[model samples]
Target: MSAQKVAVITGSGDGLGKGIAKRLAKDGFAIVLSDINPDTLKATAAEFQADGVNVASFQGNVAKREDQFALVQHAVDTFGRVDVFVNNAGIEDVMALEDVTEADFDRVFDVNVKSVLFGTQAAAAQMKKQGGGSVYKIINACSIAGHESYDLLGVYCASKHAVRSLTVTAAKELAKHQITVNAYCPGVAATKMWDRIDAEMGKYMNTQPGEAFEKFSAGILMGRPQVPEDVAALVHYLASEDSDYMTGQALLIDGGMVFR
Candidate 1:
């Protein structure tokens, strides 16, 4: 077993997940990157390697329970132990509530909710097996939508709400094992996911591309759009010893979007 700590971040091929992985790597944790997209995952692993990061990459669908388990196993196989597991893989559905079909509900919930639940289970089991004094962290990726619902993102919001619930329940259950489960909720961000949201929302709102994103950004009290670093900073805190006493909380890192 290696001496350095290990962290497994799902959907780390791009965007916020990638940023979090980089930040943790800089903090001296060996990183295991997982993504459903093989190309992006390979590229990201290469980039991290070039940057002198102790990294491994796994390609898997996070929505599957088996895949989530396999991701944790990969971390253990490559590194010594898993100290932090971030369930950061999620999908956003941009559609009116009336147009949300069963398929849409399943698609959103499977990736956003099911993945977090099973991912925490897998990480906690490994942490229990290790049985050291070290704190094991399970950080989930939630959204401001989890707190307040928007018009076209009802299903996505519901899925994130489920994430928050899972974080709280898992924290309560895993406290005995020294595993802390918490979530970071981000608002409007300058990422490819938000680009898609902006484009899809344009279709409904009858606005041009980038217009919807501008409108959403306008609501941010910080007077600036969110960056991946903003979210990564929060995740870094949750993963570090500084947040050892914090759990069961879905913290909003959205720059004053939802004030709850």
Candidate 2:
């Protein structure tokens, strides 16, 4: 195994995932970035390489069990050992709870919940092989929706709630293996997800674009919108030895939006 830690981050081609990959790379990990979008994956890999960071890119859908396994194996193949796995690839579906189709529910759940489950399983298997010790971390991408159910975001909320549950259960089960499982619950980061959310909620609420996002941001005690870097900082902690003792916890990194 290589001396430097290896981190495999899903959906890291852009948005919060990209930020997490960058921050972790800055902290000296050899990064393996994955995304379903091949173009985005190539672009992010190039950007990281330009900054003198060691990075490899893979294009795979996070919702597939086979793909999840491939991501972990790719890390091991390229970097020798896997130290961190970030299940950050997720999508949002903003529809009225009443109007939500079974298909929509399955898609959202598959990407947000199922991906984390299998992704964690895949990573843990490798971490255990690397000596069944707390030398590895599994971080899930949760959201404020996981904490509180919102109107149009019900399905998305449910999916994240499942993520939170999985994080706890995986932490407990993987503890003997010395693997830490945790999640970062971000509120309203100004990413493309929120931009799409703003537009979709506008359609449901009969409001203008940006209004829903503004309203949510207005409620933050910090009085400002969260950037991707805010979430990345929390991830940096979770991925480091500083958080070795922390697991099974879904930390709220949302500008004080929901106090736990």
Candidate 3:
């Protein structure tokens, strides 16, 4: 309703989500940053405020439909319209096929697959009512482990493959309503989630974090790792007019690692 465009980004407390929010803000969208972590949410919101970017903050778990619904609600209430919704809040639990626990699988699916489903649904409803807007999901490069397989990361791979499928399906279903659904698949980016996981895994495996991070980036075609901002740029393009004609596609932003 406001003249300025509005963008609601989840997991925006840090890393990929924060980067996407920042980029979209620069692209002229008022930002609503959401995350389950309250301190981080406040901190991230402060960033946009300091830069004089129109911004708001909310704390909620993406997996909860009620919470997810409130996310959009707050943005609309604060900004008066929702022009873009970036469902970037997701978690992955790296586990071996045989060692995968029930809790581990559920945790990954709840946020990565289920939350994405509902987040898109909620945003699409708003967009459909308002005529149209863009919905994007920032799914990490699961292609390597997804298309093929890497050791101890099977669950994460499968969850991302599910996300890939979901993105295209939503795109096709929502296109008729003038809403576009797309995904940015980043290859081993330096997000907070990845950093924490790398540190934990490195300690467990008796390897340096650099060694682990290097091995992760080795699979990419560029052989150089990705930073959060790299993925954010693609997210910006996907959420903008330039990509209006593009929908139902998972655009790989993974430094060419997953391409055949």
Candidate 4:
């Protein structure tokens, strides 16, 4: 068994997921990066290898339960044990409630909600099998919408809400196994995902590109749009021993966007 901790981050090919993987690698964990995009996954793995980080890459859609299980298995096969598993793969749906179709609802929920549930199940099972004395963590990627609803994002918000609920339930169920499940809800980060949201909102609001992003970002109490590093810092805490006593909580790390 390797002495270094191991963390598996899904959707880590880019954006916030990639940022989290980098931070964990810097924290001395052997990283297992998983993503549905093969090219992006391979590129990210190469980047980490160049940086001399102990890393592995797996390409899979986390929305599938079997794929989630395989991801955990890959982590264990590559690195000895899985200390932290991040359910960070999610999709954004920007459309009015009435405009949402059944496919849209299913696509969003399957990736955002179902992935978290099964990912936690797989990680918790592995953690339990690893036995006692080790503190295992299942950190989920939630959003500010999880705590509050937003226009044109009803289904996405609902999916995040489901993620929060699963986080709490998994925490309780896995407590006896020394596995802590918690979630981090981030606000308006300057990522490619936000770029897409901005574009969609532009069409809905009849505004130019970047206008919607500016408007949404202006509401941030911190007076600045969120950066990936900010969210990564919170995830780092949750992955560390410092947050061992904390679980069953959907923490809002949105720079004062949503209170409580």
Give the number of the best model, judged by lDDT.
1
Candidate numbers sorted by TM-score from highest down? 1, 4, 2, 3
| Superior by lDDT: candidate 1 or candidate 3 | 1
What residue pairs are clashing in model 3?
none
Candidate 2: list runs displaced more than 4 Å.
132-134
Give lDDT per model, in order.
0.94, 0.93, 0.77, 0.93
lDDT of 3 by residue, 1-260 (tens): 67888888888898888888899899998999989999989888887899999999989998889888888889888988787888888776655578788988989888888878878877876776675343432222223344445566678778888877887888778777777777777778766677776775686578887777777778777767888788889888887888878886677778877674
Worst 10 residues of 4 by lDDT: 249-258
Candidate 1 local lDDT, 54-105, one digit each (tens) = 9999999998999999999999998979999999999999999999899989
Pairs clashing in candidate 2? Answer: none
lDDT of 4 by residue, 8-61 (tens): 999999999999999999999999999999999999999999999999999998
| Model 3, C-alpha of 27: deviation from truth (Å) | 0.4
Query: Could you give candidate 2's per-residue lDDT for residues 1-260 as a string of tens digits?
Result: 78899999999999999999999999999999999998888898999999999998889988999999998898898998999999999999999888989899999999999899989989999999998344589999999988999989999999999999999999999988889999999998899989999999999899898999999899898889899899999999999999999999999999988988
For model 3, the superposed segments whose C-alpha errors exceed 4 Å read 132-148, 203-206
Cα displacement (Å) at residue 233, model 4: 0.3
